[model samples]
Target: MKDFFVSLLFFGLTGYFIYLIVQNMPQLFTETTTIKQYGLLVYRLIMVFVLFNLGIVSSKNYKRSKPA
Candidate 1:
């Protein structure tokens, strides 16, 4: 039960961070009207994906290493 709550908290925080980045994108720069803006978004999304995958793998390994 405790692990479940912790997992939920992690997911909630990740989602909130994503939401924040998307929410203020237009106001972030003055010249975002070009394709460069989309490029930046793609880069950020890929980085986020990689980080999330690392977190998942680390969590799984942690569980596997712990003896019940």
Candidate 2:
């Protein structure tokens, strides 16, 4: 049960990060940028992906790992 809520929270975080990136998307195209800025964007995307996968794996494993 606890794992369920935690997984939901992680999913929510992933969604929120994606929302933030999308909301900022236009600004990236509207201005000049540097490699460092693009690198930061890639880093954020990787973090969002990790959070999403963590949510998926934790939910899937909880059933098998539940205490007897």
Candidate 3:
């Protein structure tokens, strides 16, 4: 039960973060130079990677806490 809640919380926060980024995407792209666009692309990729790894680690820990 606790593990389920923890995973839910993590995903919920991740979703919210993504939502915020998407909501601000137009502002980020409006009249931006090529360099600035590339920078935002890289930044978004890093954020996704970090969030994916966080979910993976959280699941691993949750599994480890359970016995066979």
Candidate 4:
């Protein structure tokens, strides 16, 4: 059950991140002279952080739960 919930949360966060990127496609691509580039960079950085943290946590839990 714990693993199920954790996976669900991870997927939810990832889906939300994708949604944000897709929704901002216009501002991220259309504004060649605007400052929206910074926002896109920040969003990508956040997605990387989320994916990294999820991997770290899942691995830690797997290691702890494994039998010697």
In candidate 4, position 42 carries an lDDT of 82
What value does the lDDT take at residue 23 in candidate 4?
77
Q: Which ten residues in a row have the lowest lDDT in candidate 2?
A: 24-33
Candidate 1 TM-score, C-alpha based = 0.57
**For candidate 1, lDDT tens digit of each residue in 1-68?**
44444555555656765876688687666754667666766766776676566557656766766779
Clashes of 1: 0
Best-performing candidate as measured by TM-score:
2
- Model 1: clashing residue pairs? none
Q: Give per-candidate clash totals.
A: 0, 0, 0, 0
Instruction: Give the candidates in order of lDDT, highest first.
Output: 2, 3, 4, 1
Best by lDDT: 2
Candidate scoring better on lDDT of 1 and 4:
4
Query: Which of the two candidates, 1 or 3, achieves a greater lDDT against the reference?
Result: 3
lDDT of each: 0.64, 0.83, 0.70, 0.68
lDDT, candidate 4, 1-68, per-residue tens: 46545756776777777777677667654547366676676876698578657956875676677678
TM-score of each: 0.57, 0.78, 0.56, 0.54
TM accuracy, model 4: 0.54
| Deviation of model 3 at 45, angstroms | 7.2
Q: What is the C-alpha RMSD of each candidate to the true structure, in Å?
A: 5.0, 2.4, 3.4, 3.5
